[model samples]
Target: MSENLGTMTDFSPDDSVMLKDVLRGLALPQKNIPSLYFYDQRGSELFDAITELPEYYPTRTEIGILERHGAEMAAALGPGVRLIELGSGSALKTELLLGRLEDPAAYVPVEISREHLLAAAARIAADFPDLEVMPVTADFTEPFDLPEPARRRVERNVAFFPGSTIGNFPRGMAADLLAATCREVGAGGAMLIGVDLVKDRATLERAYNDAAGVTAQFNLNLLVRLNRELGADFDVAAFRHQAVWDEDAARIEMRLVSTRAQRVQVAGRPFEFAAGEVLVTEYSHKYTPAVFRSLAEGAGFRVARTWTDPEGLFSVQLLEVPGAAQDSSGGT
Candidate 1:
């Protein structure tokens, strides 16, 4: 563990870039906002709360898979591997993998929020004192360099992308991001990812539109973020959170619909909204094993193994590059 916990590779997007992205999205006819912006300190906290809700089954279910079969997942990766986790919020599930790994080289947690990333890295460092904890403050969806660990001889780099965060991107973008991750981890490396399986429409809809309304708050916080950071005057109360399962798209679309006709100014620019108009916030796509295997293969990875709960609500898959040896572990 590094004594200077504050030290990290910082490639975080600047405010000017964020303003540009927001403006560009607003200019589109569909009116969308990039989901990456939903991880400011407050938004991150809200999301942590969301995972605890009864309706949000992905987190707990994935954690259960990790707890039950994490050793096998680690064994499939072999030893002295440098673990890189994308969108590693709190990293509660990662501890299981780390504890089971044999003499791991280092742990790199890439996240968008600096505060949350650092706090989680500090805790991991304290608990795994012998392991190197390197935190990177950047959007994992984009290209960024991984910091080299000083103390260990790394055998390989394995990316841990959990919580079905990959579902946020459309199919094309998700494939591209996986390709980029493949490049980051190099030829012989692998990726251990959590993927949400396609299930009943009712259960999927309930997961996003929770009874506690925390998911609603999580969706609305994006506007609050824009208001505070970009000097936007958005009547947060004038909009209502909505989550609709788009059957054709096989995704849950999260949006903010205007309650009434209104105009909002962001970064000194005006945007109009009709009473029933919606501004898309995020999309969560579900996949079956075959569909996900195609998606992974398109990104240059071979599905080595997959572990799922008995109910098959979620899966934690190990995907390896061609140079790595394939494990014969069967999927549940």
Candidate 2:
């Protein structure tokens, strides 16, 4: 095993409290749950499969963005950056990034799953032997403290939030992530975030609702998680997968609608949803070039550079901290 950065860390109570608040939105009675919890080990493996599916274009498209801009992008980060990755699942996209970084201090992969986090950190460390690998097992949506030595050595914390995961959150949480990362990494550093761009709803819907049924399995897996962890009796098979594009909202929404009205027991409590009641599983908010930059600016990030794929399916934008100065079109 590659050595951890002389320090290993876990989430603090603050982190736990914040995560519960964000995730508890599921109980709202009108909406479905967020698919974030689908990342627990098995779900992570399923996602790895989902990335390889023919319909899932975001991963490969985002990879293309990195490949085209990787070296230039790395140079743009300035020298000797301590790269921190949020939701660092498998670190597949990030391996492309590490190729471009001019090694400085350490690499911190912050993942809620300790297993995935350590496995990825270990693999990356083997490749970048000189770069210290610090893995923090904690939820990225919540506040977390980095490993002791990792925190001490961080000169500039460059966070790589790939996978367009920002779309999963509502606008408020998205804003909070931007602000929180800025506060955590503090001023001067930058955040390279992957965002899915506004595209034809047909294309968007197909990507999430693949013919191979991997996305469906992934969506349904959340119910399995809730059942196991929360003691809920979710007859997951009784749900139908639905993907609808909300054009006005500029996002693709995934839902699990009940096939029949049924009462389900969760955490020793029972609740009923009428047939056709939708459980919103995920929302993939697609952004235009302008709206995206405005969002970062709203949350204290100065937009630096935006890289997109040749087909315009996805975007990887770099935002500077303490906010970026504005030009007529928005941050540069």
- Most accurate candidate by lDDT: 1
TM-score of each: 0.96, 0.90
lDDT of 2 by residue, 271-328 (tens): 7778999888788888898887888999888888989888888999998886332211
lDDT of 1: 0.90
User: Candidate 1 residues 1-332, lDDT tens each?
Assistant: 45734378899999998999999999999999999999999999999999999998999999999999998998988888889999999999999999999988888898999999988999999988888898898877777777777777788888999999989999999999888877677778899999999999999999999999998999999999999999999999999999999988989999999999999999889999999999999999999999999999999999989999999999999988887533221110
lDDT of 1 at 323: 73
- The C-alpha RMSD in Å for every predicted model, in order, reads 4.0, 4.8
Candidate 1 stretches greater than 4 Å from native: 1-6, 324-332
Provide the overall lDDT of each model, using Cα atoms, as 2-decimal numbers: 0.90, 0.77
Error of 1 at 300 (Å): 0.5
